[model samples]
Target chain A: QQPVQSPQAVILREGEDAVINCSSSKALYSVHWYRQKHGEAPVFLMILLKGGEQKGHDKISASFNEKKQQSSLYLTASQLSYSGTYFCGTEIRAAGNKLTFGGGTRVLVKP
Target chain B: SAVISQKPSRDICQRGTSLTIQCQVDSQVTMMFWYRQQPGQSLTLIATANQGSEATYESGFVIDKFPISRPNLTFSTLTVSNMSPEDSSIYLCSVGTGPTTGELFFGEGSRLTVL
Candidate 1:
């Protein structure tokens, strides 16, 4: 099943911060994040393992809550270049290459 | 990161017609994935192709409609058969960095417009 993302969309300004949350009904072994700009392929951001791990890439960071089967992405000091749709992919089982992506969160940062 | 190249980045097809998108990778990959995304929509997994085996398609996707061929470790092709306007979307080919890591590198994507 596809995961659910909250705050369907968020508008931010440069130097602002925002959070996007994704939750799944099933237990997950890992959570993966990706960002896609208009007319482009989704780019890999970071992956968080189970056991309440947190990962970061540049100003973007994410945390996975194993107990809750959810993950949250944090955008710190947002930049205009960060404008895009964010997607979280959940891996239900270890070694399972198959991933179910959540409904994306569209983020727009304006100067 | 693997460098993937897709052919015919954009194309227009007539209803009931077919179009094939080719994907080539710089190196051998253990797994290749096909995804579809409509404009302003989330990416949907179509199938997973492995060399020397039949592609495993996700629910709502059938081989009869989207046939995949993995001729080698570094090349694969997805053929959209009997397309309609609903099939008009961006088709992306992604390569798994490893079997367990699950980090995917995506191709530029083939944009198909069916009329």
Candidate 2:
């Protein structure tokens, strides 16, 4: 099943912060985060494995809650380049490595 | 990281005609997947292409409609057969190096517009 993303859209100014949440009904083995620019393919940002592991890069971070089957992406000091759609792909099982992506959160950052 | 290339980046086709998209990876990959993204929508998994084996499609997708060919480990093709207006979307091919890495590299994607 497809995961659910909250705050369908968010607008921020440069140097601001934002949080996007993705929740799934099924148990997830890993949660992957990606960003897609206009007319471009989705680019992989980071992956959060089960066991309550959290990963981050240059003010962008993500956490996975195994018990709750949810993941949250945090973007701090947002830059203009942060304007795009964010998708969370969940891996329910480790067998096929298949992923079900969320509806996506559109983020717009102004200068 | 894998460098994935797709042919015919964008195309305009007539309804009832079919188009085949090709995906080539720089290195050998264990798993290859096809996904479709409709206008203003999220990506949806169409099928999983396994080398030398029949492709495994998702619930809403069928082999006859989206036939996939994975002749080797580094190459694959997805053919949208008997296309229609609804088939107009961005088709992407992704390669997974391994299941444990949880990372997927994607091709630029083929943009198809059926009129």
Candidate 3:
């Protein structure tokens, strides 16, 4: 099943912080984060496999709460490059490597 | 990580026609997946293409409409048949290194506009 993402869109000045949340109705085994720039393919950001696991990339970090079937991506001190559409992909129990992606949240960071 | 390349990076086709998009991986992979993303929408799995077997498609997708072929471990193709305007979307080719790998390497998607 597809995940539900909060704040379908966001606008922020450079150096501001933002949080995007993703929740799924079904049980999840892993949650993956990806970012897609305009006219580009979705790029893998990180994957959280265990419950309460947190991973970071530059100023971007994500936390997975397997118990709640939810994951949150944190973007701190956002830069212009951080402007893109973020998608959370979920791999649920018995789903193997197949991922169901969320609707996506568009982030726009301006100077 | 694997490098994937897709052919016909973008195309405009007339209704009632068919278009085949090709994907080539730099190295061998176990599973190849095809995903479709409508404009301003999330990625939806079209099917899983595995070597030496028929493709497994997701619900609302059928081989007759989105035929997939995996002749080898590094290459696969997805063809959209009898296209309609609603079929316009970006089709991406992806693959993981192994069975349990959570990260997928994706090719520059093929953007199709059916009119």
Candidate 4:
């Protein structure tokens, strides 16, 4: 099943913060985050395994709650380069390596 | 980490024609995957290209419509056959180390616009 992403769209001023959430109805083995600008392919960001680990890159970080079957991506002190569509791809343990991506959340950052 | 590239970044084609998109990886990979992203939509897996054998397509996709060729570990091609406006999408090829993390690296993608 496809994952659900919250806050369809968001706009923030530079140096602000925002959070995008992804939830799945089924248990997820891992959750992967990716960002894509207009006219480009999605870029890999980070992955959260089943152990409920939190991963960070630069000012971007994410937390996965195994029991809740959800994950949250935190963008702190957002920069202009942070503007893009963010997608959460879920991997189920029984489904091999295939990923089912969420609808995505469009984020815009104003200077 | 793998460096991937796709040909024909964007193309406009007539209906009923076919377009073949090529994907090349800098290093050999055990698996390569093809995905379709329709306008304003999330990525959808089309198939898993296995070298030296038939491709494993997803539920809604078939080999006749989206033929895939994985001649080697580092290269593959996805051909959109009998194209129509509905077939227009961004086709991406991805490769990963393995199924453990489910982490994949994607190409720039080949954009197709059928009219």
The alpha-carbon interface RMSD of model 2 comes to: 1.5
RMSD of each: 0.9, 1.0, 0.9, 1.3
Give the 10-residue window scoring lowest on summed lDDT in candidate 1 chain A.
A91-100
Highest DockQ: give the candidate number.
Answer: 3
Tens digit of lDDT per residue, candidate 1, span A20-88? Answer: 999999998889999999888889999988658998999999999989989999999999999999999
Query: lDDT scores for all predictions?
Result: 0.92, 0.93, 0.94, 0.92
Off by over 4 Å in 3: none
Candidate 1 runs further than 4 Å off = none
Expressed as tens digits, the lDDT of each residue in B1-115 for candidate 2 is: 8999998899999999999999999999999999999988999999999999999999999999999999999999999999999999999999999856568888999999999
For each candidate in turn, the interface RMSD (Å) is 1.5, 1.5, 1.4, 1.8
Error of 2 at B20 (Å): 0.5
Query: Taking the candidates in order, what DockQ does each have?
Result: 0.71, 0.70, 0.72, 0.64
TM-score between model 2 and native: 0.98
- iRMS value of model 3? 1.4
Cα lDDT tens digits for candidate 2, A1-111: 999998899999999999999999999888999999999989999998865889998789999889999999999999999999999998887755588999999999999
Q: Residue B93: error of model 2 in Å?
A: 0.4
TM-score of chain A of 4: 0.96
